[model samples]
Target: MSDVLVAVETVSRAKQLKAATGALHEALDARMMGADLFSSRDRYALFLAMQRRLHAGIAPLYGEPALAALVPDLPGRAKLVEIDRDFADIGATPPADEPVFVDPKDVPAALGWLYVAEGSSLGAAFLLKAAEALGLSVEHGARHLAAHPEGRGLHWRRFTQALDAVELTEAEEARAEAAAVVAFRRVSRIAEETLAGA
Candidate 1:
């Protein structure tokens, strides 16, 4: 158990979740090579390829009963199609390599993965603007970074509400936190690979 997790034990599950995953998030961001991504079209395409890989890795979890029951919108949230649209708009094809698989063996772990995915939509507001600066838009490209149809804030609140509503043993909670860190690391690696390829 991490000291951060231990310290957040008394907080709401959502807060605990955020606190536990904070370090992993920061580390992943540091490795994402954001400045380089926005510097060129090829770099931006590589970033989208990385997004495709990460989203594909977790796409299977949306169908799990435990996850689907809580997040009904899960099925529609797969970003691969939107990513493909963005690729077409940019005159690029998706990379041929297989995605890094991120399998969560149980419900709690799936929740952890979903937390990262759903939370990403909240951050996409900034990314969307950055994409626009590259001449991409929700209608033409960057659909994956577009604001949710239901609105970002409402969508995230619903997700966190369902997340907190789930009951878990301490062990399960730890597993969830661990899974979140794993998700971050996997995406970070993909980002690094994308930048290298760019």
Candidate 2:
């Protein structure tokens, strides 16, 4: 029998999204590296401040019914609560204002934002380890970086499965890609602005 999948793009949505934003992601990673983000308590606080901005910016997206339909656990995926607690643990308050990028109801663009937000949890595992050196942990100043109760790999797989199953229109696909780029650029910009203020 002939294979039934020949027409489908073998590339997964997760991979396509990664490819779309890889360069921007790497540039931000390099900038974070050079920022000495974990070098000391002050630097770590600045890093957390930067994180506060990014996570707060997208915190609203997790609640959109359309987006939640895509990723069932989307509400539980929010890091703002943990980030807020981390700020408290560090004796700092996250600044009240954060720039909003996309409307939460814009499901396509929101997915792009979610791509960056959710994917960062994997990297957070490493950041959590680094936070340990600064006397931070899941219970302390690094709560946002703690692993999911379901485990990181499995959690990521669930998100990817949901992402991959989405069948977006050509126009929607373009929107998603543009939004992903915007999300990365926002992170880069926020990193610069946060560190500059530091």
Clashes of each: 0, 0
The parts of candidate 1 lying over 4 Å away from their true place are: 1-10, 97-100
Q: How many pairs in model 1 have backbone atoms within 3 A of each other, for residues 3 or more apart or on separate chains, i.e. clashes?
A: 0
- Across residues 70-107, which tens digit of lDDT does each residue of candidate 1 receive? 77777776777788889899998887746435554488
Q: All predictions: root-mean-square deviation over Cα? A: 5.5, 2.4
| Runs in model 2 lying further than 4 Å from the true structure | 1-9
| The candidate that achieves the highest TM-score relative to the unseen native structure | 2
Tens-digit lDDT track of model 2 for 121-152? 97788788889999999999999999999899
Question: For each candidate, what TM-score against the reference?
Answer: 0.87, 0.94
lDDT of each: 0.79, 0.89
Say which candidate scores most in lDDT. Answer: 2
